[model samples]
Target: MNKIFETPLYPYTHHPDEDAETPVRHKTIVVGAGPVGLAVAIDLAQQGVPVVVLDENDKVSFGSRAICFSKRTLEIADRLGIGQKLVDRGVVWNLGKVFKGDEKVYEFNLLPEQGHKRPAFINLQQYYFEDDLVARVRELQEQGAPIELRGGCKVTEIDDCGDYVALEIETPDDTYDIEAEWLIACDGAGSPIRSMMGLDFVGRVFEDNFLIADVIMHADFPTERWFWFDPPFNPGQSALLHKQPDGVWRIDLQLGWDIDKAEEKKPENVIPRLKQMLGEDAKFELEWVSIYTFQCRRMEKFRHGRVLFAGDAAHQVSPFGARGANSGIQDAENLAWKLALVLEDKAPDSLLDSYSDERVHGADENILNSTRSTDFITPKSQISRTFRDAALALAGKAEFARPLVNSGRLSVPCAYDGSTLNGPDTDALPARTRVGAPAVDTPLGQGWLLDRLGGRFQLLTVDADAPDRLDVGGIEVERVAVSAAGNETLRERYLGDAASGVYLLRPDQHVAARWTSFDETAVRAAVAKATGRDK
Candidate 1:
């Protein structure tokens, strides 16, 4: 037998005291070495910002913590330089089936509508996930990417004094002090920095608890998401099953706040539960086990002066939808470019405020969805459970009741509707690629539209040349021209029935503005608004 999740642990290194003559001040300091922290550090380093990352642990997460990687997260990983590795090393699945007792309720697919580059989702363990990110960051480090990953380093104190944020970090042997113009808190749900500032998260905590087990065995499980409410094997409780890479199956059993937490986690207690579901003949090895309660909460604002929060530090949702890690990755993507532009003096500092506004809006959406899923799965009151049971009963036979049945909504990219940074969208345009939406991935002649856009401010032109007369406060913008001869999706998304179209895209591949014709004035105005120069 082979261990599919193999990764080398990082080494613990010492941090020297700051030289009195010339202290090495970093532009950005990121806390934690998890996927979200590594991602934000990588994004900042790619944009030529020197970053220092601190982590108490010396390796990737040990277990299959977050197994679901949504499409938006993979796309962001693609831009950060590790999309293919994540795709190639994970189990891909799109179809999901939901059931009640012994009867099948319904099934669904996430990527039913085609025309995108990435799949709907992939199942991967968190250990391999962060390991791959660390490898990529090391590869870039060799090429002059100033990303300093200090494993076994813990942040003891954070001193925020408006102009700059100072950190007192301790290593295994010694302690040192450092300073950065900006600090990104990716330290996770129990954020130390967030605590130091007396910041509180306001949200609901469900009474139900869940037992998650990663079992390694050769079984007849299909490569799909199977969820059951009041299943035959585990009567009166819910269960979820998914196939991950390397023959490891993730099983989550909803034990509604009544079982002994310590006893259920024991192999003696867990194996019998498995026998009821898989029968006595099914041989399996228990790889890992954990018990957790659900809580959906987030900081009111992501930014506090020079310090900003990303990933789990900023918000936290229940594991039902897999929104925890995926949304955290998007937070890094959303803040990195804005921070880089502001640091380089290309944009006003107020541009970072938009990062807070937009991502706060995104966190709210994730929390809302996660709360609804948690409520549906583990209803609090008798009336709520009655409504849930009725919906599940109707879902097995009635087509109209399918929407009411919620196992888990899964995760999706957030469309930032009503964002202040959003510019004009021509009337009667396709709503899919409208302002405040993620730029639709269109298939070009031989590549994808996102590949051509790169990581800069790109002006996507359909049936029009790059605007030569456009100038937005000396901001550098790249123009990519698309033709209708081979690229129909681009025109359909941006131009609609119009003859030509021009779209200004943010550095993060989000649609800023679009118009029926190529107007240099409109493009520049959008740039001004996006960069916070106009507003």
Candidate 2:
């Protein structure tokens, strides 16, 4: 058994030899070697389930696709055990300035309070982010995780039988058939897997095409997000300048509705526009530039039989709010654990249905937010444009507009309010309710147990001495010492002085439920619901 399992990818096959026959079956076959696919593989492998990952690209791609990593994504990375490395390498961005013409309408400080260990957002290139994740997956693979990476392999077809999926994979060497208990498609927007499944990607594509360029700059710009509405270089068009690590900057120019695609790709044309935006004194060299159209869409279904869709394969949102890749990574995190559970038989196959239900809700909400953001910035009609201009004009006035301007609507965390799997709220005290808002902080850790608390499910009880009052079932419970001053301060930050007691945390770190005191029956129920043990 030890020799058979010595190679991380060996256990799923009959033997380790090159000519050895492929296994008749696998627990999971994840298509796409992108961040989402790798995340799913890592999650399942950690749980001792066999997973095989396939990618058409032989190597990781360069260029920054998504630049903003939200706090929620950071929390997810932390759960995967690579959060600190990401933080150390990425640039922490908490301040952003929104400009309308020459005037700065609103400046936001993303971190509203001190003592929080993590920032509200971080700016890192998507390529670097994937690099960290791939490294971690490789580490896990070395540690006996059953994760196989088949580079140059692409899924051509998927047959989703009730019990298993037969994947037709094409490789440089030859085409072959791979059978798995389940298939997860993380392929991008042009996903053949989605097409094969006959899922409709319903949404409209924006008419305006945008030019994106990553340039190395000699001039010093404030390490902040800068957005220009109706800039001189491209009147009635939006321009964005964001700082990247190593003096690199990402610049985007709205090319309007009528630009020729062939002309825009030329360095001569792109460089002049970039020079006009940054000024001649800036002295910058263009790294990479491309013209692409943005769209807002979501799949009709996230799952079809034994196959599931994740990341861009599941949804595509506009780039205005930086939600596209971030939301996809979140989907990966959400589905990974559920897939792991189903494969382990710790939860019934019905648990798989919740993946589509919960993630579709998230994806739809993301699409709505992105669409609204796109409308606000790129106003489709004259009336809409006028309204946006007036709003920006109003925002220029500090007294009349600060509150409205500083809503941080784009940065709001998603709430799983209408989830079918979420249990009923049974807490008597309003302070004890964990829904809508995150778990309040206690001095023992940091703000929002949802953010600071780590590793597995934790049932936190305020009654430190009432261990007998706790129910030890299929979950783990810890009676934190909230009596100390430091712990008290932490508690006060999240829960306030009026709130105290026990909280149940789900494996994903969201607060499942909370009570003013230890209630074994309620605790067990919450645990059961969270673990999908409930009927």
Candidate 3:
């Protein structure tokens, strides 16, 4: 086991609330100390919301559960002040190779273009990811941000008392009751909070399992994503190889639905399989091993009265696309700013409804793609297998068939196209920067566009005239002006053929509205609309 997992980062501590005469209410409470929960707490604390994070455990996660972090996730982490740490301690890769039988089919690049500050993806252990987030929380604590992480605090019961949520938490020494104006649950896939609320997931659980093994070995494999379909060693099944930090390599091997999971997990069985895959002389030590089944499901709604759900507690998808943790982190980012505004009374409580609406939209997109990838990878029937095999075979010889080959359609940021918060959009501007899409990064004179627009409602104007700042219904929108004359990337990404463009960006850095020219009335209406005050 790694030292990170052995040491308790947030050990159990007695709270004054435990001995209080009555339950003490807090502004916000986050259940679970995972990436999503910590992220939500950090964002809220930075925004001046007093938050308490309770988790059942003390140390970081034991294994490298979610090793692949996408660029969009990195960008969001950058806003949280820990993106560079992840990139620095991760194996960055954008290239992926697919294989059929013993032959290499084709390769693809996730981010072939440049001007973005981060890479397409990075491979780091989940433990490292959580460690960095917890460290960030400590930094915020030192700076007097109102955030507290309490470990060994298990939530035994929950009650949604109309305007607030009451919780029963068990600590090592004693149990206590607490209340919160709002509660955010990030308790992972098997969420007790969801169960206590009598809520359940609705979707498909495929009849297949995959054996994941994280082995520490010095290998000569290139730093890239290598996925194999019906490889020689793992015949009639699929395999995936990914490189991680600290000589750790993740290997996933398909295990048919009907197999002894316990027996297969034995070292006697697992070692031979790895030897067959990595050759007889390949030496390695097993760091972690687990078996996972495929399930693409989500709650009916993320928000349930006073308690809101984010991350695995709200939605789940097949891990083939690396959408699990990435989507969860994105959920935190989407909900944080909205929840902050609602708590501060800057926006109506109805604004939080859009959080559920928009995130459910994102969850559905991930589920759809994840289901398709699962079908292509597993192939329920012979006909489906035949079609998949044909696609892979033709993918090498034909350019058009390459798109048909699905070795897990990699994760991407979901654009809220039909979101109610989306305002007007101009077709003359670049479609990538249109309404409801995530703002694409462009290099400015000294820093990046995303860095300047960090975690706030801002007006991005390129070769357009707008006031330095605008007060729209109590929301401040600062203008970031840049010329597109010499910046070709900015011109192509934001301006296109249009001479100038003005964009209203949400605090999450998503475009709420865009136009070829600036209009104060239009911008004010957009701010109102994006904040859920349009009605």
Candidate 4:
């Protein structure tokens, strides 16, 4: 028989004291081994930085939480070398259907483009995703990478020196002091670390309660995103049904404010609701159930001296847009490279400030979308609901109102609009990809463009060759030359019918600069700006 409970993910490991009196010091210590923390740790380890990850629990996420992994997030995962594992273990989805009383109000497709590497989103239980990342960390350990995982450890205190951050950690049996030149907090929404420092999460909270459930069954439902507004099965409330891996399905039912959450989550109260939706005869087992109310909020500053926050620790958004985990991992991607460079003394520590600036921009984008989604889903007033209904009613027949019908905007990569680190746009790029944008994946022979670009600086020459390695400040770069025929997408994205163009890609795969031809001085300046040396 299948186990009723998900497996405990990260078993505790013992670490001996450093000499007897001195505390163990690492280059970087990451608190919380969830998807965000593990991604940051793996990224730092791959860049040759030693990391110690501490988590309070040894188990994978208890429920099928955070099932949707966005494509941009998958690209970040690919950079961390765990993309294939995540995709292989997930259910790919691209089509979403919005319904009003079972009358479909137009079907929407997320990924209209073909030949791209990943789908719009993949639905995998958060536990499996974390498990794969932990496995990657172990693999890196076997290869002698300096990444350590200490489960069942809780951070008790933190001290930020001018140059380093010190931490007090407690295990079940004893307490120990550890120090790091840098600290990354990937703790969840109620982040103990954030609370330890007394940072405020300032944002709006929707006055509604949402019930989330994971049902275990072999159902015949199609593997796609299905959202309902005022669904007849559960009237006057929004609901979402999504397919997950492991024969489990995630159901979210909106219950208005003032209900007792404890009473609602009981099987006696919840199973009947499922029976109402799935009908009386549908056989299923309850995997998990919980009630949640979300607040779209974020820290004012992601960087606090030597301590940095990423993932849920930094910002939070409603699950409607799938922004929370995806943006958090993107935060790891944005921070890791900058942190590694600063720790290596290759770039000034001010480079770390750009992390706060840029991610705040990303967080604001997420919060804005989340706020809009919540407003549309649960309009604050009857007038707003009437507007929403009229929009949805018109969406069923007309075209323009479909844009206003916001069940959830769905997650997309947040373009860094005014980031100080952004490079100048060269020519008129055709592929919607720009200098500040995350590099779009283009087909290169049989592989993908992003596969070659991550983990280090690269100079991609489209239809051109042999720009004597663009080296700057001890950072060596690889040059990839793409032929026009094999790289049709690349040409369309970067070159755009120009004879040739040079794209400077940062380690995080964001394009830093581009030129019609090679210019070492221009590349170096852009590198300086990207590393936060300019301002």
Candidate 5:
């Protein structure tokens, strides 16, 4: 019924079933239509599961909420078929600079190798990214993919029934009840769904506040990220400058806890700080500015019965590392395929339990890392502040201290090692070792590395002819033989040598297990445990 689906690219053909009247229920109901929520919906629809995404807003939010998309997220977007669009629209940034009082402390060039399918990071406005994703969702809807978007529909309550979930939604026009076998809450930090479930989101909220301003500017600053600690213009405070699309830039100015929250947001107070940072000669117009408090927190459990949490609903981290949204999208990617498999009966419902365990682990790790970065950037006590200043001064001179200055705190893909669903790396095979997410690189085939490995549970064996020696049933195995002398760059990046034999990749592209001799029983059992079917 949405008018956006009338375009030529949007193909909608409703399949009339004789049993269509049986109360409409989707296999999955996703709350919140933000990037993370949409990513989950798209992945589920691609795997042939019906999904419905509900949001209170009719369109993308206006603010520049999240801007940096990491390589792992780009891989997820590539799997969803929209990576090229993102690449074309975003500004690829491979370097960063850190400064203390107009002196360059350190710098980093993030250009990894040329063989990577994507860049290290892309800077794009969060609104633009969400808009493009929404367009893609509309296109998929036209193709009769069982994905539906209901805008202006607010979920008022949820009743979890262990096996399923029932939601009461209030739309602008009517109030209705929807049922789904599973529910995913991608709602923002003040999640109504998480609250309705009586979950605890415990964490610390920093006393300092930040004034976030998006502005169109003409400046000589480099495209790389710029951070200034206690610059003369903003003494006793921190500032950041990031180049965004369309000649605009994002600026965050730290406002100490002493400032009146009500009065600090006025343009009169904000523009002067901008003028001081940019100098009087610089010309610019402020687009938007607001004051926000930062928090580092995570839900104790990511999943409660049949309802799961994703994005801000599950965890909230200080925006220092830009890990808040990035981690959320990763959470969605990790949960989607498992939910799809459960719906298709390819895996048991117990597989859903792993969603909470794995993501919560990652969220806890992210919170700790981001919190540490925040403390380093914005020291609260006098002793801590003195230590931070001394550290920066030392980093400015010491070559070995440059890494600390560059702050290698970007979000990395998380593994499922300590979870109940994942098993230990046993010493059964000579050269096969299965651990962590699969490292992506240009392989023998012309297709993408992730493309070759994503979609279903894959078993990459060193020898294709050794099927008789492997008992990998209920899983798709792709046998790829690596030369004893591996690709030089890949060897240096992954295993120190190319002598490693085979790798078993999960649906999410994480390595499940590996073996050198193509031992059928070991590979089969590894796949079973990775897929939560070993029992």
Candidate 6:
């Protein structure tokens, strides 16, 4: 248990606005200073939008929550200027092993290919992640970024006034009012803001619970995700293990719905279970312990008037796939650019509707996968369990059954396949970089391709003729020209069999459109379609 988790990073302080004649309005206000909130705030501030963040607490998360950071999330973090710090301080792993009743069934490599800079996943405690984000905020503030974080400031009431959102915030010593031209709610799963607005999630809540134990120990377990179904120690149940930074290991034990959660979390009962799995003599100290239920749900709509929701406030999923935090980060990234554009008058307010549409699609994708993983992990009926066991047994001997074995489908980037923002596409280029999909990373010059994209709308040309820059309506699209002549990986990823390719990328690095060759008229229309102008 690091002291950083309890230390106040952003203690409450008096502000001039508290004594103002009226509510001091800001261009943007973010509620809840968690990872997603901080991420979006940083994004907006970097884009020169003055944003304020309000949080009731002043410290990082208390436990080893959200231990897995996906590769796509790391790329987004790179744009936020915090990617390398997370990678440097996290456990990098790409291999996963599954077992059935003490026998290893099969293994999988998440990222088998080369040329990508980031690993498939990194295991770091959520507290460490938040601490680094707060540090990044401080660094950005030092560099004169227009971002403010107010701790111990709990937003008690939210009033959506069509044009702006009025908020009532409570501090330790006083209460005050403020207004925001646009509001972003990144609160937790049990979001008070969402409750205040009388909104609710609509999805499944599985009747099962999982115990998470963050144990500090010196173990020889390889740095890979290991999952066991009906292991000896936890008979008739499933378990998961993974290495984290600072000699910590995260263990998850599935407990059927009937058990008492509080008793299961007790060390008196938890230690014996650990001893059974670790041979009675293992030396370990419990750093954190908690029980969680599987819930795959999301709000009907993420946007309401001028207030928008991101992260757990908008959607939630089972922990098995590591989609919770990762998807939330994606939500933040998606909304930040759109909100920024709308506020700057570069795009219409209808552009924000695409945020809701795209993220709801993402949430539904995560929910579907998470629900399937939960069902497979915890079969409701005996026949379902029998089928799962059969799949597990066959996975040990046959390659085809391996795909049926669901040790929890690991998190992957959600491609907005049919988003309205997606522009024209050609079958000539690679499908991996197709319209609405994220731009695949490849080696470029001495660096990586993603490092150059960096949260900007750009024209990616692979040996294709395009202008140095183009002003589509009011938005600037810079040209990034790279020849695919000597770059096989780049050609394979971007050009494929096509002689040349041109791509229009959104600020989030998603392919808005692609063409075999650049056409000025078509490019302008694509930009209009992407910005919600055409609609």
Q: How many steric overlaps are in each model, in order?
A: 0, 7, 0, 0, 2, 0
Clashes of 4: 0
Point out where model 4 deviates above 4 Å: 1-9, 466-468
The lowest-lDDT stretch of 10 consecutive residues in candidate 5 is 9-18
- Candidate 6: regions farther than 4 A off: none
- Quantify all predictions' global Cα lDDT against the true fold: 0.86, 0.71, 0.94, 0.86, 0.76, 0.93
User: For residues 36-125, could you state the per-residue lDDT of candidate 4 as single tens digits?
Assistant: 999999999999999998998887777777889999999999878789999999999999999987788988899998768988999998
Better of 3 and 5 by lDDT: 3
Clashing pairs in 4: none
- Candidate 4's TM-score: 0.97
TM per model?
0.96, 0.89, 0.99, 0.97, 0.91, 0.99
**TM-score (C-alpha) between model 3 and the true structure:** 0.99
Candidate 5's displacement at residue 429, Å, is 11
lDDT of 5 by residue, 1-535 (tens): 1222222321222222112444356688899888999999998988888898888777676667798888888888888778888888898888888888888888876765677788888988877778778888877888888898777678898898777797877765556676789999999999999888888788988888989988887767778988888888899888888998877799998888778876887888888988998887778887767888878999888878888899999999887777987899889888998998787776888888888888888998898888888888778789988888888888878977665652427777676666665544534433223475444655544555566668776656442335522335544665544442445644544344334546677777877766544566777777778768877
* Sliding window of 10 residues with minimal summed lDDT for model 6: 454-463
**lDDT for each residue of candidate 6 in 12-61, tens digit (9 for 90 to 100):** 99988899899999999999888999999999999999999999999998
Q: How would you encode candidate 3's per-residue C-alpha lDDT over 1-535 as one tens digit per residue?
A: 5788899999998999999899999999999999999989998888888999999999899999999999999999999999999999999999999999889999999999999999999999999999999999999999999999999999999999999999999999989999999999999999999999999999999999999999999999999999999999999999999999999999999988998999888888899999999999999999998889999999999999999999999999989999999999889999999998898788899888899999999999999999999999999999999999999989999989999999899999989999999999988998888899999998987889899885789999999999999998778999999999899999999999999999999999999999999999999999999988878
Task: Rate residue 140 of model 2 by lDDT.
Answer: 88
Q: Between which residue pairs do clashes occur in model 3?
A: none
Of the two candidates 1 and 5, the one with more favorable TM-score, higher being better, is 1
